[model samples]
Target chain A: MSAAGGSNPEYVIARVRARRSALFGDEEYRKLVRMGPAEIARFMEESEYEAEINALGSRYSGVDLIEYGLNHNMAKQFNDILDWADGRLYDLIARYLRKFDAWNVKTIIRGIYSETPRDEIETDLIRAGEFDDRLISRLLDAAEIEEVVELLSGTIFADGLEAAYDDYEDVGVLVPLENAVDRAFYEQLLDGLVVGEETKQYREFLEAEIDFRNARNALRIARSGADLDPTDYFIEGGTLFRAAELAALATNPDELVSKIRDSRYGDRLSNALSDLEEADSLIGFERALDAALLEYADTLGYVFPLSVTPIISYILAKEREVDNIRAIARGREAGLPPEEIEEELVIQ
Target chain B: MIEAIEPLMTALQSEAASGPAISPSAAAALAVGLAAFGAGYAERGIGSAAMGAIAEDEDLFVNGLILTVLPETLVILALVVVFLV
Candidate 1:
């Protein structure tokens, strides 16, 4: 827990491996998909989510209980990992976890813009980031988007958000602010990362994530046929597409798909790429991207057992578990068939 | 400094001509010390990892303890030199 001391990767990896073993497997997900929301709550109470489920049991019911329990448990588990890491490990982990801070800031800005109640917005805020509760509370109290931007002035999102605020004023849309936040998060993701042998794979993983994000943005713009400039949404640090290239590729989905097919990720994403051609929807392709990334991180963890890879793999797996469970619970609540819900899960 | 150490140097040279710089037992002792140091360094990682496992699940205490001390075999093997010398 001491950030000043040398990193304790041995300790963290040990604990993380133990926890990783406890994560839901294919059998568990297969069983969970069949269960109703109430049954799922009961099922979860007997597992790693027991504490969160029980704590929120009386306050919420059905899918809401499951959703809240998943969020709370995810936040607690990630926070525990952060607390356990020290020195370089903490910095590395915090770099990724700061995405939650970005998520919270965007949530708050959107809530302020939409005039949503503070309490509702508070529940949506995931406290798994480096931002402390005080700053988060202060953010929640900010009545205007300008105040939210001001509160984050000392953060990485400050400069991008400030510039985007002017765009927001001109367009009267949240896209500029949200994109700015996303760009800030991605920009800082690889900022000053020390690329040792162990971290080289990690760097590649981060780059792939950025690449996927950019690809997803380009594909979306292309599919929607919106006259929006893809360069505006282009995140740096991705090797796959330059901003100018993305601008060009966004006009033609076929050429964009071919470009991705020829890249290094082509082999891994070949199936998803074909599925994209057949389905004419990006949802399956997007889910495949997530699954590919998760599987890649999972394998990389074993390549260097003592490095930050295992911890990151655990983070990704835990997030996937949360997301999968949420999808199942929400799907069941909506009376969606088991087969469709199964398709929605991003399991490897 | 050279002039001051000339007599000491002659004495060390004479000693060196008759015998090894260190006695066999002393050399054995040095090996054991180095071996023990290596074991301790190895155990530092194992011990922390074991403690982490034990913290997560109390039933792992016995397993953790065994793994933590597995490296001590190096020291024990090194001790055989003490008797051999």
Candidate 2:
């Protein structure tokens, strides 16, 4: 309990595990998919999101209420993680949490590029990263993408963003800058950790994540038959696809699936891969990847009980809950059928 | 090197005649104190983990308290050495 006693993983994990248990079960999602937007909000108010839903209810309604509640709960859960962690534990958890920074930066740049209002952009940011309020406010206040990049001057994202700004100019597209930010985030994710037995396993887990992301990107490119270069979207650090291999494999769906089937992730993704072969729906396959990641994270939690893996696993589950709730609310608002909406929810 | 402490044998004779400044009972008591220190050190991690669980659920307080004191069994066993001595 003493602040001076340093990191309390036990307390954090205990609370996290309790919160993890409270996430919406599969049955809840099934019931939620059948409800309307107002009904979804009502359901949320009775769950772990009650505080967030009540707090944001005055300003937003229906799907917006669900969206704000989801984002707020996401921020609160992650911020609690950072607050609980200390020493090297803080360092490890914060590394993964930088995804929010990537998300915030991309949102801001896209908003500024499209001239969306600052207030709207600010609402979307999950303030759970290493970035403080001052930095985020500065980013919001910036009138242009250049100014936004300049505002982030000394952060890890600065250099890559600055470089991508040129590519953004040449093509007049936001893809370059977004890719730069994503590349920076993943690059720094596993950078400079002390090598040990447990960390080695953690490293492999991260690499698997990167590999899955690359596969998703490649599959989308191949399926969409986009004229854009697949290599450009290829993120480094994944063991599955080298950058050059993406270009050739991206043109042929059968070869791409075969290559993935032979790779390290083959075992974890066999069912999803088979589904892709049968149904030819990349969306379902992507959802399968997400389920596989969730299951893998759960396994990692039990293997390294007191390590960073459980903490990350909890984060994933919480994020999934928020996403599922939002999907139900949005699906209801959009008048999508219950069964279709239920398909969108990744319950596993 | 294997001469087996002739100087300490002579010192012991002289020292024992002076009725030994530190008795075996005192030595055993010191052992108990060190064992208690070891028990306290072991309790540190368990105690923190217990408090953590208790904080999440009030119902766990009793269980946490029980687990926290489990290491005290070491010190209790160390007490047996005092009686033996």
Candidate 3:
């Protein structure tokens, strides 16, 4: 692909930077937390989501409209990035966007398991992944889990899901199947990732993400005091903890704290570890991870302005936007006050 | 693409090997023209990127225009070449 055409990283980065600056910052989320769902949707309609809002207005209303608009805007913005990128940029961006594909696949499988209608499952899908319409349509048409696995034959999720299907049959739970998909995606993300000066930095950024995710999962399992194995949920390629280490640490919260305190991420996550000790809150730890990821992305962007880091940073920020907006909308609907709702958002 | 430059390189070299490539005025003109070519090449990239930015947000028009011509200083420097030639 790189041989067929040269990429314009500088040009694309310039445009991406412009778009990045337009993403909502802390103050915006704070204000958004103060508004009701209708007000939030109105605010979105007057912002970058205007077109999506207007288009989905007739089909949905209130929080549903906001939800649809958010999804629509996410798809559109990501599609625009794909449209602008060329050659290797396209490849790099596609690598990350496939996360959504993993998300959609999980959603579909869970929905099918719960016996949801195909159309309803389809509505939850974000079509920003590399999966073409035909593939998705075939997936939607699948009548059974076996059929779904068969339909996914050519995709990255195929083999993993096939194996997981066996475990699913034996256990009669979807954990194995869903985990297979997540592992497949994460494994593929770092496969064959040769790095240059710039992409090296991008690789590091990605590792930070992997590390944080593993940490979050470990913390969740640790907090729940569940009997399940932590290694069962371990994702590869993170620089922090190994599967065995995480499995061991999952059983002891204090030891996990000391382990995290001594790791390379210790400095960045110190406050979170303290909060974990004091408030006994996983939310604080999760927010700290988010903040750390955002800070890492920011640093990476400056270090490699013309590479994939900025694009990845933008993707992270955009995802955060969708999450924050959703949090605000849901919080309002649940009758939570603005300040309490704001606590649920991660705006940095 | 590279072959195009080979003949031009030869022509320039042959002219210089002569008693003089041209009169001082003509030599200066050549210098200015070369500078202008370089500037234009630089502008091609900047201008396209600037236009892209402007298309996304209209407020960038002035900043884009300024950046597009930043390389024009090369041509202005070549103006001195005109006098020296």
Best by lDDT: 1
Chain B global fold similarity (TM-score) for predicted model 1 against the true chain B: 0.83
Q: What are the RMSD figures for all models against the true structure?
A: 2.4, 3.4, 6.1
Segments in model 1 whose C-alpha atoms lie over 4 Å from true places: A1-7, B1-12
Deviation in Å, model 3, residue B36 alpha carbon: 5.2
Tens digits of per-residue lDDT, candidate 2, A54-151, equal 99999999888888888988898899889888777788789889999999999999999989998999898889888888999998999988898888
TM for every model, in the order presented, reads 0.95, 0.90, 0.87
For model 3, how does the per-residue alpha-carbon lDDT over A1-348 read when each residue is reduced to its tens digit? 132244366567678778888888877887888888889989998888999899989988889899989998998888788888887788888888998889888888888899999989987989878887788888888878888888888889999999999999999899998899888888877787868877887887778778888888888898887788889899999888999989988888899889889988899889889999999988778888888887876676777666778788888888888988988898899999988987777777
lDDT, candidate 1, B1-85, per-residue tens: 9998999999899988999879999999999999999999889888999989999999999999999999999999999999998
lDDT agreement with native, every candidate: 0.92, 0.84, 0.84
lDDT tens string, model 1, A1-348? 223554399999999999999999999999999999999999999999999999999999999999999999989989999999888888889989999999999999999999999999998989999899999999999999999999999999999999999999998999999999999999999999988888898999999999999999999999998999999898999999998999999999999999999998999999999999988869889988898898787787877889899999999999999999999999999999999999888886
Q: Against the true structure, whose TM-score is highest?
A: 1
**Candidate with the larger TM-score of 1 and 3:** 1
Q: Which has the higher lDDT value, candidate number 1 or candidate number 3?
A: 1
lDDT of model 1 at residue A115? 100
